[model samples]
Target: MRDNQITKEFFDWIRQGNSGCIFAKLFVLRGGDTPWEASVIRAETFDAPTVEAIGETLKLASKRSEAIQLILPNIKTPEQIARMISCLCKNPNWYCTEIIPKPSEYTSSFLAGLRWKLPDAVNVNWVLGFADIETMPPTRRAPYTSLAIRLGQPGTAPSVAKDKPNEVRSRKKENGLVPVHLADMPTPFLKDDAIKKTWVLTEQTAGKMLNPTPEFRTNAHAKVTFALPMDLRDSLIGCFTPVAMDSKSEIGAEEY
Candidate 1:
């Protein structure tokens, strides 16, 4: 499907008021390193009947993943990370989140504290591998002209003169620390020319893709079994087992 079509379908699916699990998978197509790699990182079973519930689920999943850290590594403070993630939750379009340094961190304790937060029937183990992505392409090296313009200007407060070499090195790091512009931020999943896309699928649609038949438990297990080094396939398969229904009889019994 076209990228725009997929995006619309995703939003529409999320708006449906069905009581079932929802799963989101992120896919990235790198230039030369790897053609494509994906991870099913977010899943929620909602009893509430509202589109907002779906948004809340995704926001919570994003928070649990610590997604801001993936895009901004220098933001070491926890409060800052929380605030940034909060902002993204409100306006995911105002800024973007990327998985930097690699995707392994998403699986490593990404769901550690989530057990108590989720409904008992909703299995957390269903999520595979960490959702973290490797580092954003390094900021393009700054130009010499820009460096000269920045260094030549004196600080707002009075300061003693330092050696040119030391002064230049310090200013270089300072200039590089400027926050990256939203437009300049690297696209994590698509080529430079390809259109970026996202999709949200209901559990049934996702299941069809991941586990089409009774024989296969999950699509991830079938397609990327080797990629999952944690070896949690058996546990994941167990989680997919259908919940049984109660067999209570409705007819009243007569007493002699």
Candidate 2:
């Protein structure tokens, strides 16, 4: 049939490594038949003159074949974009094989938040869903304490809880980072004073901290956060005394 032949040819075109697209913030680039690099610049906005200035960056990146982003807008029209994309397969300096049309919301938001601070290049492997992204690099100062408290007897446990209305994944351990802001150095709360000890108080003064003394808060870099591991959860058998507290989050309550 005519349709069958046309479909075969279209699939063949893609199968030959002639073209492809990814749904991330970047498009994959190939030199010869091997994918060696990637870029944020898309062919749909083919502003050739604007990219002329950064042509060398593209060439160098392609040669190094590093996965990084470029600042180049594309042109209009699918036909025009096709021509621009096809150009990637040709010239050695301009060997840009595939052009990804759009970026996912997660990838776009992640890149947008960091591009201002790290405009040059961001490691593709650093995004979410990838391997562990170390909040504090191993090269940094060693943690003074890593309290891993558990409640119930531990054995085999599922990574996520599914019995409830929603499934919740287990949390990884987080290091408490110390804060060293200049304004916090003078407010010490660990002095000999009965006047300040009459009432039960949580450290919400001079900014706010849940745990860690005010003196220790300024000296050590730490944030007040509390999270319980799902695997350690156990139902109480005795009478339960309920305790509740009011709190506000900087962002707000998350829906999903």
Candidate 3:
């Protein structure tokens, strides 16, 4: 009876936009069952909205015993970013976002070296061996992050997640259970490079991001990614508009 009430109230709180870290700590500390089992139970029972609201909490529970996800920004080409931005324009939420690092040697010939530089501060492959970010307090996590480390070492790769948002969205019984992927988007802006040129965060800023900073970097041979702390996600999204002619606007600047 007590557990049932606790679970119900936790989901309610999350639906109201309260952070899930408090309940997550309790779940991690006292629950008799494994976190993944709990997550599956919730996934099976809750409606879509409830699941989405408490997604991070469920993710936190599922990852309590293991590593949480990590972010590797700036890994995509102009065309890839444009495709993603197009998808995001229509459906702002993606169920799972993958970070598959490609070597710089694979880059285009003309702008290969000048376009991007891989992180120099950390061993970008440590994640392949260790697997996961330090499970921080759950807020809204970025879908299901699958960090792909391409080394051929056995047991060194993260498995692709089975239960992603696309599957869940298609499974509502009303819609036919056909998955919708990024590639399915019909009108991706392939020519857009403006956003790429203006991206600001670098390895220096991104390293200070997570709760407990990681010891090593991902072994990316090219420009992997750049990101900010998750708390500012909403504010950041609000600023994702077209850059004006000057492109010199700073935070709180009148010109912006």
* TM-scores of the models, in the order given: 0.16, 0.18, 0.17
lDDT of 1 by residue, 107-131 (tens): 3211110011112222111111111
Q: Model 2: per-residue lDDT, tens digit, 1-256?
A: 2433433433243244321111110112222322223233333543455346445544455344323233122332223323443333233222211111133211111110000101222200111111011222111111111111111111111111112212111211111111111111111223323212311121222123212323222222222111111121121112111212123221100100
What does the lDDT read for residue 124 in candidate 3? Answer: 15
Higher-ranked by lDDT: 2 or 3: 3
Alpha-carbon runs more than 4 Å astray in model 3: 1-54, 57-59, 68-106, 109-256
Worst 10 residues of 3 by lDDT: 109-118
TM-score of 3: 0.17
- The lDDT for every candidate, in the order shown, is 0.22, 0.21, 0.24
Point out the higher-scoring one by TM-score: 1 or 3: 3
Off by over 4 Å in 2: 1-54, 59-66, 94-256
Quick one: best lDDT, which candidate?
Answer: 3
Off by over 4 Å in 1: 1-70, 92-256
Q: How many pairs of residues collide in model 1?
A: 12
Worst 10 residues of 2 by lDDT: 108-117
Ranking by TM-score: 2, 3, 1
